[model samples]
Target: MSFLNTLNLTGKDKSVGLLLGLILLSHTERTGAKDKSNVVQKGKGSTAKLKEIMIGRCFNYLGTINPNAGNKDCSKLWEAFLRAFSEKDPCKITKEDYKPFLNMADHDIPIGQSIFWSQTKELILQYTDVTHKVMPLENTLIGFMLDGLNWCGKLSSPGPNYEACPEWNSCTNHSMGSFWRAASENYAMKAQGEVTVLLNGSANAFRENSIFREIELGKLDSKRVTSVHLWIMDNIDGPDKESCGVGSVAVLENILKEKKIKYTCVDNYKPVKMLQCVFKLDRPSCNTGT
Candidate 1:
C-alpha cells in the first residue's frame, strides 16, 4: 500500500507492468541465445574485400590477357572458390577442394611461356613484370587473384573467418597451401613446350618439398613440356651455394633424366642479371658498363 500510494498505481497497472517486465526478460533471453548460436571469428581482413579484389583482378585479366577465356562469370567463380572451404575445417581442406574454382578460372599458357621459380620469388616476379614474355603461376588468373591473400573458414562461420587463420605449417592440409597445390598442378599441366625455371643459385635451389618440386615439376606433362631451362641465379655480391650440375641442382637433374625431360641450366641468365642490375647499380658486380 505504501509503495503503490507513492505513484498511485492500481492493481491493473501493476499487472500490466509485470507483463511488460516479463516480455522484456523473454526478449533478452531470446536475443542472447540467438547470438550464442551464431558463433564467428572476424578475420584479419574482410571476405567481402577479398572478393572485391579478386573479382576486379578477374575482369582485368579477361580484358588484358586472356580475352580468349570468354564468358567467365566472376561471381560464379567466387562462389566456387567459397564452396571449396565454406563451413569446413580449415585444417582439412584438400587440394581437391579447389578443383571447381580452378576449373572455372583456367586459361591456356602459351608454348614456351611457362615459368616456375623457387627461392627466387622477387627476381622472377620482376622478370615477368618487366619482360611480359612469360607467365608464372602468380601471373595467371587462378594464382594472381589470390596470391598475396590469406583466408580460412570456421565451423561457426559459413564463409571466411576473421581475426585469425592458422599459420601455413599449422596443419598439413591448411586451406592456402592446398589451394596453391591445386593451382600449381593446373599451371604445370597447362604448360606446353619449354618451361623456364628460375632457381636461387645461393640456396638449395630446389627445396625438397617446395611447390615447384612436388606439384609443379611432377605435374608437368612430359608429353607437353620439351625442355626445362633452369636459371640458377645468385646475388651480384656473393655467397654462391649451388649452381647447375651441382648440389641440389644436380639432384634435380637426375630426376629430370629419370623423367626423360630434356633440360639446360645457366648461371645467372644474362637477361635476369641485367634486370637485377637495373635496380642495384650500387653493387660493383652490377656495374658492368665498362
Candidate 2:
C-alpha cells in the first residue's frame, strides 16, 4: 500500500496532516536562522558596547589616578585593544597579543594597597567599597576594562562570536582567559611595598594552579614588593579548613620562602569578617568578631 492509503485517512485528514507538516518545517527553518542571526548580532553588539565604555573608563581612571596626567586619546586606546584579538581565532589568542594595549595606560598602583583575590570577589568589592584602601585588579584600568565582559572573534567573522565561545577549560589559549592572565601578570609586576591577597579560608586558600598562585604570585617582584600579606577569610558560619599554618596556606608559605618573598598571614581578618557581616547580618560571627 502507498503511504497515504496505509493511513486510511479521509481527504480532510490528509490535507490536515500536510498542512501541519508544512507549518512544522517552516517553524524549524525560521528558528534555526533566528538563532544563528542572534549569535552574530549579540557578539558584535556586545563587543562594540564594551569598547565604548572601556574607552571612557580608561580616561576617567587615568584622571583619577593621576590628576596631572592630562588628556589621552581614548580612541587610540580602543583601536589598540581591538587590534589585539580582532580577526584572530578565538581559541588561539595569546597573552602577548595584549602587550601593546597594556602598555598604553600602565600606571603605578598605590604602594601597599594592591589587593589580589582567588575566590573572594564579593568580599573584596565590599571591603574596597567601604574603605577604599585596597585596589583590586578590577579597580585598575585594565581590570575595569575587561572584567565581566566576554568577547571572542573568528578570522572569518566580522566581530566577536557571541553565540558560542570556548569556556575557560575548553581551550588553553581562549581569548578572554588569555587577556585576564596577561592583565594579572601586568598588575602583579607593578606591586610595590606591602601587597595583600584575600583568600577563602573555608577551602584550600591556595592552589598550585590558581591564577593567584600561578600567574600573579610568580609575577610579583620580590625586590619591588616589600611584603605579601594574606588575609585568609572564612564564611560567617563555618568550617574553616585553611589558615596561616594549615593546608594550602602552608604550601604557599613554603613557596614564598623559596622565593625569599617576605610574607604574613592573618586568619579570619577582623575587618574582612566585618564586611561579610554587612552582607550576612544575621550571622553571629559578623557581630562577635574581634
Query: Which structure among the candidates has the greatest lDDT?
Result: 1
Could you give me the TM-score of model 2 versus the true structure?
0.79
Per-candidate total of colliding backbone pairs: 5, 0
- Per-residue lDDT tens digits for candidate 1, residues 1-290, read 44345556677897766666678789999877754433433334334577788889898988887777677888899899989987877778999999999988987888899999998889989999988899888888888889888887766568776656667776898888899888888888888898999998887888998889888888888998899998999977857889899899999999889999999999889999999889789987687872
Q: Which stretches of candidate 2 lie over 4 Å from their true place?
A: 1-48, 63-71
User: lDDT tens string, model 2, 12-116?
Assistant: 899876676678789989877754543443222234577777877777777775444345567887788888877776768899998998888566688888899
lDDT score, candidate 2, position 250: 91
Q: Candidate 2: lDDT of 70? A: 43
| Top-TM-score candidate index | 1
For residue 227, give model 1's deviation from the true position in Å. Answer: 0.9
